[model samples]
Target: MSNVKDTTKANNQLIYAKRNMWTGILFGFGIVAFIDEAVFHQLLHWHHFYDKSTTEIGLVSDGLFHAFSFFATIGSSFLLADLHRRHAFWLKRWIGGIFLGAGVFQLYDGIIQHKLMRLHQIRYHVDVFPYDLVWNITAVIMIVIGIVLLYRTQS
Candidate 1:
């Protein structure tokens, strides 16, 4: 009986941890996407989500990207609320997940989108090396922070 009870408790903890981590990931991704769209695309006019075409198409692409971010944020908020209601929220784990997700998203944007896919550069009329270096390094730092926190294994 004692062993069975212990197993069940451990399983529950695992489930809670996973839930918290995933919720944080979703939230982090959405927030980063929103920031990229608003700051780089709209405010600075550096580049659009898809800049392979005319300005009008780029604006439309930005709109779609914004919508995706909005939905991700909203969905993650609901999941987080559910976790809170169930008394399963884990703060440290959630934060770790956030950093992990943000780092992954940023890295993807910097490498795949900016380089491989040729979606857009960080800036149009500037040397791009510095921008790329800073972006990737920042992403790596966030990923390290997230890994450390997530692996601490303490509630």
Candidate 2:
């Protein structure tokens, strides 16, 4: 029947849209990670922005690991969003909450560990102030926005 055919076409279009959206988000995250790890770390010698001493390099490495973890979390969020479209409600909600919680924790860590304690510095800055509040704030804002968008789309 024509009605059945029309319904199938619409369902296929919805799936295609969701797939494209998630792919785009993952691609954007990859670009950001590439810039941070490759251009900033290797080419510029910026390495964690401060704590340049040999002993402090370990701490810097930890920070890099944390950064990578954040990206991985976002990728997982995309997967959850896709699953949600396929009727996996509980799984989607759990992943959404996890993403939101991780974003909040990262913001707090940036403030306390990096800014208050002066554990690291923002690169290319002449000032002794190690913490770049601007960068931290922008990161938090982006994370929150992404989480909100994901939640809305899933709902």
Candidate 3:
């Protein structure tokens, strides 16, 4: 009987961790997108989301991006609520997921968008190298923290 109970508990933990991880990823992506759009695109006025196009097109693109991020956040919220209802959500794991997601999104933008696609640099009218270095380094740090947290949760 004790053995059966222990097995059940372990199984439950694994199940919860898996579910929470997915939720964390979605939430993470949404958060990163929100921050990038809000900070880089708006507050700093670094560069529009789509600068290759006209101003009207850039604004339209930003609107679409905002909409996507909003939907992702909404989806994450619903999933989190379901997890809470089941009493299976793990805060540490969820946080880890957020860090992972944010790092991934940032890295993707830094490497793929800014580097490969030439979409836009970190800032247009400034020294781009410093900004890019700082941006990528931050992303790496977040990813490392996320990895550590998620690994700790396994115990």
- lDDT of candidates 1 onward, in order: 0.88, 0.54, 0.85
Clashing pairs in 3: none
TM-score of each: 0.90, 0.45, 0.90
For candidate 2, lDDT tens digit of each residue in 1-155? 99986676456435554453444445445444455556555566655534646646745774675476567647756765665565433433343344444445446546774668765554545763434565566557757765775566552
User: Model 1, clash count?
Assistant: 0
Number of clashing pairs per prediction, in order: 0, 0, 0
In terms of lDDT, the poorest run of 10 residues in model 1 is 5-14
Model 3 misplacement above 4 A: 1-11
> Once model 2 is optimally superposed onto the true structure by TM-score, how far is the C-alpha of residue 58 displaced, in angstroms?
5.0
lDDT of 1 by residue, 1-155 (tens): 99986676555556789888888889889988999999989999999999999999999999999998999899989998898776667778889888988898999999999999999999988999999999999989988998898898455
Show the lowest summed lDDT stretch of 10 residues, model 2.
Answer: 87-96
TM-score of 1: 0.90
